[model samples]
Target: MSAQEEIDLEFLEVEDLLLRTVPGLAEQWRGATPDEVEQLERIAGRPLPRFYRWFLSRMGQSMGPLAYPSQDFSARRVLDCYARKIVAPNPRFLLIGYESDEMMPLHAFYDLDAPARGDATVTARYARGGDDPIDRFETFHEMLSWSSLFRFQFEQMSQKCEGTLYREDADLLSLLAPVLSSLGFTQPLTTGRYCGLYERADAVMICGGTPRENLENVRTFLLGGSNAGVLRRILGEVAKESSLEVEVNTWTPALR
Candidate 1:
């Protein structure tokens, strides 16, 4: 299929997923016009990657909780801001998106001297620490796909369910849902003001509070306890099901 056609199909699939999973958020999607996209390219002085350009032409700007900057913050504005604040000099990098919290920017590097390709090196740079990107993607599409999956999973965890387990901060839940889902647990159910439950192996795992608090609770339960062996086996099953390298020893902070 042509590049545009492929992007259209992929964009449609993502949009459909978002609509079904988070209809309230999907309503904020807006598509840009061909003229607007051309203007952006002219302002940036570089051709955007094919998939990203197609997204601008089709999906425009997303204003959801998981979105980057809206259309109101033009690409030129974002790039200019990046140029001003960037600590590490990388002239080839162009701003594409930001984390949900807007503390980090997602950038794409263009190599004009190299042969043309649809893919680009995508990275996310933190604001406070070193300018180096903490995360990298081989292609922009991969980044978008990951974001879509995360959004879907986050929404799933936010839903109310029976026998609910694990209720804590939303941000913590966002990071934990995928891991728990991979472990054969049902989506978390709200059992109290700040508590929830997950069922697996015919047992209920209670979880709640901040990410740190919940992680501690989990660690205590799965270590030096009678059920530790069973929980360890279940976690192994989860590792096999997920691509994410599940490391319980460390907490990876995610932007909400």
Candidate 2:
């Protein structure tokens, strides 16, 4: 392990927030075990820096949503990328994850060879930009929490409600909790402030105001995805489960 303080562990919380933005992801998160950590280092031929090691244990299995599936974040993905020549072969450079891009995806890595192994610098190279640095971070935590959070995966359709869900917030939760769960809606998108965001592979839910306690205070409820059917399905469930009446122009009527 490198030179991480107790505060460095807070990156895990940032992981949760970053993941919440994923549109309906199904991955479950639990950092790697001690043995697995040892295995990873063994493959690398050295101990990974402290921050990267802890990051693996905490968010290794699901390091946010990345470019579709080109790069897999499996137990040996670091080596895999290296072997395939996707990233630099320097053993000290450990690939954390890739950032999705329209022009070209960016591959991010931690420089184990850096002097500050405890909190090494993170570097990213464009898919076809050669060895140039498209982005750089002072620490892995900054890379994971702040940088990754802003890099959103693509969504085809998104709609902000004209108003709240139009029912007691509790009724809305009681109405959709099971519905979302059945659809594999795990891994909270974010939980620090505001209502909350929860996602699965097909749908993303954003509740702007606190539900249950006060519906009126709830300012916005956002639902978005690749298709209108996903939005329709959620509304359908709300109607079926409870008599909640919700409607939106979806910017369609606004156009008219």
Candidate 3:
């Protein structure tokens, strides 16, 4: 696999914080079995990058700056339970699950077409909403770059304070939101009932925030695409003296 195909094993660092975020995960997270790790590597079709391998090995420990969430491999295990359908996004793919009192949708792995071609786009939709990274350049590398940025964001957020959905801090939101906005929502026309944002799996969805926890939908309709030029403009507006409060916006959350 190319360097970009490698999951940033460094995301393993925040497993403790991850466990803290989702307390129920504590007991289930035994380290990945040798077979499991090998299977994952095989599925990804590339050598598992040291970062994620380290993550699987030290599934319960905390490390690194970002501090990704802990996984007893619950999501992985959940997917494993559905082995026939829950295929890897890549040969070296890893699965992450988001569950709740209400049913959370199954995670999606692949986004665009063949990873080798570089032209990629990932999408995930729930009863509520989903994310779809707007594909600009058709190149696989460009798609991969977009994918990497998104995965980094998801893994990074997973490590933040427990029970917090998406970074709650305004500064971080301001920084990431505009760029994410460019990623595109799956349906351009929202019936005014959904929120949307990017995902680690390279898809976009309306499920940006957890219900009642951190449920502010970053308005992607305001941003254009993933290009730096577009990002600069959005970021510039973010820094403006005026707050971006708009009048009477209305949208519905997708029904469970």
Best candidate, lDDT: 2
The C-alpha stretches of model 1 lying farther than 4 A from their native spots are 1-6, 10-12, 43-46, 68-76, 79-91, 98-117, 125-134, 155-234, 238-246, 250-256
Provide the overall lDDT of each model, using Cα atoms, as 2-decimal numbers.
0.44, 0.53, 0.35
Tens digits of per-residue lDDT, candidate 1, 145-179, equal 44444444422332211111222233333444466
Minimal lDDT window, size 10, model 1: 217-226
Ranking by lDDT: 2, 1, 3
Number of the predicted model whose TM-score against the real structure is largest: 1
Off by over 4 Å in 3: 1-9, 24-28, 49-55, 58-106, 110-172, 175-242, 246-256
Which scores higher on lDDT, 1 or 2?
2
Ranking by TM-score: 1, 2, 3
Error of 2 at 47 (Å): 3.0
TM-score of each: 0.46, 0.41, 0.33
Compared with the true structure, model 2 gives a TM-score of 0.41
Cα lDDT of model 2 by residue, 195-241, tens digit: 34456676666554321223342334556665556666776775676
Better of 1 and 3 by TM-score: 1
lDDT by residue (16-102, candidate 3, tens digit) is 334433434555445556676776656566654344454455451322222224322332563463475533244322342222324
